[model samples]
Target: MLRKALLTGCTGFVGHPLLARLSNCDFSVVACSRVAMPALPASATNVLVSGIDGLTDWQVALAGVEVVIHSAARVHVMNDQSSDPLAEFRKVNVEGTLNLARQAAEAGVRRFIFISSIKVNGEGTPLGSPYRADAQPQPADPYGVSKMEAEQGLRALAAETGMEVVIIRPTLVYGPGVKANFLSMMRWLHKGVPLPFGAIHNQRSLVALDNLVDLIVTCIDHPAAANQTFLVSDGEDLSTTELLRRMATALGKPARLLPVPSWLLEAGASILGKKALSQRLCGSLQVDISKTRELLGWTPPLSVDAALRKTAAHFLEHRTH
Candidate 1:
C-alpha cells in the first residue's frame, strides 16, 4: 500500500533533489514541472503543466495523489524593473499556489506541504535575535508579501476544507546546482579573489539541501506537522567573513579578505545601486528552529561546513574551465 505524492517544481533547485530522494521512499511520486525536465527517476511519474496560476488545472495529475508538496513559486528576480512587482508575485505565488491547493483538496489530497521563505519573517534580524515561527510577519519585499499571503490563504483553505497544511519557511538554501549570490561567492573563493567582508560580523542562518529535503520527507507523514508553520535552518549560524573563509578552505585557497568598513561597503554599494546585495552580505538574519526541532524532534542532518564543502566540490567539478 504505497502512499501517492504529487510534487510541483520537479526541475527546480530544491525540487530536483527532492524528486530523486522521494523516488526512493516508500511512497509513489508524481513529479510535476512547468518546463522541460531531464529523465526522471524510474519509480516516479512525470507530468507537465502550464505555469502555476489560478487557471492552471491539475485534475488528472492530482488523481489518487494523497500528498502534495508545493515547491514551485516565482523566486527572487535580480533586476525586477517591473511596474508592479507585488502584482506579478501575487499572480503566481498567491493565486497559483491557492489554485493548486484548492484543486488538491477537492481531489481528496490529505496533506499539503508548502515551501516558503524566511523573508516572510522580515528581511534581517538584530544580532542574537533570531526569528521565531510565531513572530509577527513583516514581509518587506513584494516576494515575501506574496508568500505570506499564500500562507494565509492555505491556512484559511485548510480550516474550510479540513485538509492538512504544513508550511516550512527556510533561509537561504545552497547545494549543487545553486545559482546567484551563493554560486558567485563560491566562484570568487575558488579563484582566491579578495572580498571586502572581513569587517562585517553578522549571524545568518542557512539550510542545506539535504537538511531541507530530510525535513520535507519527515513532514510527509508526521502527524504533528499537520497545519503547522515552522521556521527551519541549520542550527549553526555564521558571518559573511566566516562563510567566505570556510568556502576558501574548502576550495584549497587562502581567505583573501580585506578589512573594509561595513559603512564604507554599504555606501559604495548604495552608490552602485546594489544596496540589497550589501545588506545580505553585512546583515544578520538568524532563524530559531526550536519549534521545528521540539515539535517534530527533527534536526539538520548536515553541518554548515560539510554542506559548504559539498557545494564547493560540486562547483569545482562542474564549472566550465
Candidate 2:
C-alpha cells in the first residue's frame, strides 16, 4: 500500500530536496510547481510541474492526492525597488495558496502542509524575545502579511471542511542552492570582504535547509502535527559575529570583520534608508522550537556547522570563475 502525496512548490529550495529524499520512502510523490523545475530521475517517481492558475478543473491533480505540502510563497526583500510589491506578494502568497488548499480539501485531501515564514510572527527586527506561533500576527510587509492571512484562511477552511492544516514557520533557512543574504555572505567571506556585523550581539535562529525538509516530512506522517502550528529552527542560536566566523571557516577564508559602534551604524543606515539591511544583521530574532521537538521527537539531522559547510561547498564548486 503506497501512500500518494501531492507537493506544491516543488521548484522551491526546500521542495527539491524534499522530493528527492521522499523517493526512498514508502510514498510515491506527485510534485506541483508553477514554473518548470528540474525533473526527478527515473529511480524516483519523477516530479510533474503544473500551472495552478491555468487549471480549468482542480480534479486533475487533486484526486487521490493524500498529503498536500504547500511550499510556494512570494518571498522578496523589502524596498527591493523591483516591482509591484503588494500585488506580487498577494497573487502567490494569498490567493494562490487558498486556491490550492480549497481544491485539495474539496477533493478530500487529508492534510494541508503550509510552508509559512517566521516573518508572519514579526517582520524586520523583533523587539526583544522571539515571536512564537502563539503570538498575534503583526506582519509588517506585504509578504509577511500575506502569509499570516493565508494561515488564518487555511485554518478557517480546515475548520469548515474538517480537513487537517499543518502550519510550519521556519526562520532564515540556509543550505545548498541558497541565494540572497546567505549566498552573499558566502561570497564576501570567500573574498575576505570586511563586514560591520561583528559588534552586534543579537541572537537569530536559523534553519538548515535539510533540517527544515526533514521536519516537513516528519510532520507529514506525525499524528500530532495535524491541525497544529509549529515554529521550527536549528534549535541553536547564533550571533552575527559567530555566524560570520563559521561562514568564513566554511569558505576557508579569514573572518573579515570590523568592530563599529552599533548606534553609529544604525544612524548611517537610517539616513541612507538601508534600514532593512541594518535590522536584518542586528535583529534579535529567536524561536524556541522545543514544542516541535517534544511533540514529534524531531531533531535536526544536520548541525549548523555541517549545514553551512555543505552550502559553502556547493557555492564554491559552481561559483563564477
Best by lDDT: 1
Model 2 scores a C-alpha lDDT of 0.82
**Residue-by-residue lDDT tens digits, candidate 1, 14-78:** 99999989988977888888766678777788888878899998999999999999999998887
Q: lDDT tens string, model 2, 1-321?
A: 667788777777888898887766777777666555556734334345444432324567776888888887768764578577877677778887888888898889999999999989886445447767777888888888889888999999999998899999999999998988888888888888898877888788999999999999999889999889999999888988899999899888899799976777888899998888777787678887878988899999999999989998999998994
RMSD of each: 1.0, 2.3
Candidate 2: Cα lDDT at 199: 89
Error of 1 at 185 (Å): 0.8
lDDT on C-alpha atoms for all candidate structures:
0.92, 0.82
Model 2, residue 227: distance off in Å is: 0.6
Count clashing residue pairs per candidate. 0, 0
TM-score of each: 0.98, 0.92
